[model samples]
Target: MTAKFIVIEGLEGAGKSTAIALCQQFLTSQQIEFINVREPGGTPLAESLRDIVKAEHQESVASETELLLMYAARSQLVHNIIRPALAKGKWVLGDRHDLSSQAYQGGGRGIDRTTLQTLSAMVLKGLQPDLTIYLDIDPVIGLARAKGRGTLDRIEQEAVSFFERTRARYLELAESDERIKTVNANQDIAAVHRDITQVLEYFFQGLN
Candidate 1:
């Protein structure tokens, strides 16, 4: 059987990590084989790239630079981690993927879509998630959760307007993509987990 690629995506502090982890746990209980990977930080090279991109010190980084580095990390991660895991017939769960680049760079930074499309082609090599779960949340609540996490990264330091643009772009993409599913993430953690699980169950019903 071909491996199922699932991508969990959302703004920072939207409980994406928690939801992904819960999904993994549920899959394990079902005796499913799976590999969890996070984009821009999966393999060794990609993890290094993640540090550079998320560090608070690089506040002056240009939009183009950020986009390029993200693709670089993605290129490495795909070749090193995701492809092999999938080839082995193990499910792949990604914490975040290309949609994040589209949101953060194209929407937040207002980059040219043509350039992003070209970069994605060169780096992603046609690999796409079978199912993309978007954890939707308000920017204010999301930023509040981020603030509670203590320190903020360069991207996290952006104004509310940036996040608004990011969230809007994410919704736009979700609405256009049949494989994408949006889940409300403003509720408590358990409720968010329940919604995610319900979505996943319905999605996987066909596979089962």
Candidate 2:
């Protein structure tokens, strides 16, 4: 059987870690060999880039610089980790992937879509997630939750408008893509888990 690459995407505090745990549990119940990866930090080199990108810096980080760093990390993870694991028929569960770049850099940071498209094409070379689950939440509530967690990272410290743009872009992408599903994350944890499980169950059922 062919391996499947699944991605979980959401704004900050959208409960992605919990969702990933649930995914791992579900896959384990099915006896599916799988590996979990997080964007910008799956491999050693990528983790280094992730630190550079997220750290509070004295110098202003240009939007293009941020974009390039993201793609650089993604390229490294895709080539050295994701692809090789998939080739060995191990299911790959990603905490975030290209869609984060499209939403954060393209929409939130107001980067040109064409530039993003070019970078994606060049870096990904036609790879895509078999399924993407997007947990949708209002930026206000999401930010509050994120703040409660502790100090915010660089990207997480952006203005509310930035996250609003990112959330809008996420919804737009989910609407356009059949393989992408949106879950209302504003709901309670139990409700969100149920919705996510339903989506995963439906997908796995179709696979059978």
Candidate 3:
């Protein structure tokens, strides 16, 4: 089977890291070489952008500035890292991708969808994930889980309502896109992993 790009997406505390680890294990079992990538990161310049974007600042960050920074970081990762890795016959497991922008910037920040689409078209140039798994969770529960980890980042510091909007958008997009699957992250960790594994198994079977 050809190498495919897979993305794991969710709001804070949705267990994306654990899900990514599971994906790695699954790929390893299949003997498929893969690379794990985190959005707004995965490259030197992109990682720098990530730090800037996530850091809390004295001044309020404009929605436009936040949106542009996300795309800029994404452009660097896709062109410099993701595309190259895929070209070399390696699969990519992404922590987040364009969908995050749609949910966070568009839904949460109220950015216009047309602007996002234009930016995405310019930056991605038709590249897209072969499959995406969205771990769905309520903002209240997810934020509590995230807070338990450590200090919340700038984005994570957003109000619970912001995440509500974000989660709604995630579900909306997932329902519309067959390539994206939604897994209930409110369940126990093992159950979430089982659901993810089942989704991956179904996808891999289709590839045959």
Best by lDDT: 2
lDDT of 3 by residue, 20-77 (tens): 9999999999999999899989899999999999999899989999999999999999
lDDT of 1 by residue, 1-208 (tens): 5788999999988988898888898788877899889977998889999999988662578889999999999999988888899998999989999999999899999998999999998887899999999999999999999999999988899999999999999999999999999999998888988888888889878676
Worst-scoring 10-residue span by lDDT in model 1:
54-63
> What is the TM-score (0 to 1) of candidate 1?
0.96
- Tell me how far candidate 2 lies from the true structure as C-alpha RMSD in angstroms: 0.6
lDDT of 3: 0.95
- Clashing pairs in model 3, backbone N/Cα/C closer than 3 A: none
Screening candidate 2 with a backbone cut-off below 3 angstroms (N, C-alpha, C), the clashing residue pairs are: none
Error of 2 at 48 (Å): 0.4
Which is superior by lDDT, 1 or 2? Answer: 2
What lDDT tens digits, residue by residue, belong to model 2 across residues 1-208?
6899999999999999999999999999999999999998899999999999999999999999999999999999999999999999999999999999999998899899999999999999999999999999999999999999999999999999999999998998899999999999999999999999999999998898
